[model samples]
Target: MNSTDSRASAYTTLSRDSVHEVEIKRSRFITYLFRVESEAQAREHIAALRKTHFDARHHCSAFILGPDRMIQRSNDDGEPSGTAGIPMLEALAKRDTGHGTDLSDVLAVCVRYFGGIKLGAGGLVRAYSDSVSQALEHSTLHVRQRLRIFTLPAPHALAARWENELRAAGYQLEPSVWEAAHAVLHIGIDDTEHDAGQLAAFTAALTSGAGRLQPFDTKWVDLP
Candidate 1:
């Protein structure tokens, strides 16, 4: 699979950690969904769950890391090969949040409590996939975008007015920092040429060529 899709400017992930449980043929599948950023975090969560549910038959897991969703891994635990982990991984990989199937930085674990019923390979696959699907259904999703930070300095007299104007223009503004001579207004715009040009023009119009936007740092930020 491609590391990142060029279509969507942002990616989707779980809004918060969540749990959901589903039962099939008396077998219990308790799913835990965690918002993780790295392989270490994912492993830590998995280990914690294993300790918590130490008596469970299996603790199958799958995780996709990185903003690009490039790091993908899954574990079957004691379940048959490809029946548990692969399906769970596919469920997460194919999840679409209106933007596209770009879900990343999430780890899913399905703890199974065997109920004396044996689910064949197909049934096991369905059970694992359904486990994650049900958990996601109960999850709130949010978007993360790469934002370009810019600082625009304005005189004390016009700082508040410029802040209001920028907000009205739908620019994301951070709290302004007050300095001795001027107030520095921090803004976050989508890391795209279109947004950059718009912000530059707007700032120029506000300061009449006296003010310039200084590019700050770019980082991935969770959107509300």
Candidate 2:
């Protein structure tokens, strides 16, 4: 399925790409974490890593994409079956975002450099899982909020005066569009009944019943 296909209203994702390494039994497990929106991006990242770490023995990988997490994939890359990739994927799926939201749009790849001491099935699983878990612990994360857009048209002077007031009132305003007669202020707010009511009431009061909010499509915005 497409990454944008049945998205959640809000979700958690990595703030940036990160790499964390660990040593187990003399073998190096380097975990790369990337925020990805599609399977193709995840695959591209894995391929790049394989090229960068060409000497590594194995490059096991897993990815969870889409806000709804509808696309989940893992590859063992010659590691024992169900040991490396599955555990890595589970680490991402079961990650605690502290806000109770599921983690998505993330890809984890563990490149292993053999140290001649082999980890058995259980050991491999634990090692790979720990590799991703530790990497995630060090990686920064944030939430994506889907906000509804509203446009309020007003005279340029009034728009300028109200812009600061709106910001002070905690309203999220996008850049305004200016026309000959007026300015269109783009406002973004949570797609909730309470927020809608508050915005409509506030705008009406600000304009003394002359202003009206024009609803537009929703967009996803990032929040720390």
In model 1, the clashing pairs are: none
TM-score of each: 0.94, 0.92
Q: List RMSD in Å for every model shown.
A: 2.7, 3.3
Worst 10 residues of 1 by lDDT: 1-10
**What is the lDDT of every predicted structure here?**
0.91, 0.92
lDDT of 2 by residue, 1-224 (tens): 12434547788999999999999999999999999999999999999999999999999999998878999999999998999999999999999998677899999999999999988999999999999999999999999887889999989878898888899999899999999989999998877767888999999989999997889778888986
lDDT of 1 at 16: 96
Q: Tens digit of lDDT per residue, candidate 1, span 1-224?
A: 11343544578998999999998999999999999999999999999999999999999999998777889999999899999999999999998777554899999999999999999999999999999988998999998988889999899999999999999989999999999999999999988877888899989998899996899887788888
Backbone clash numbers for all candidates listed: 0, 0
Model 2 gets an lDDT of 0.92
After superposition, candidate 1 runs with Cα above 4 Å error: 1-9
Residue pairs clashing in model 2 are none
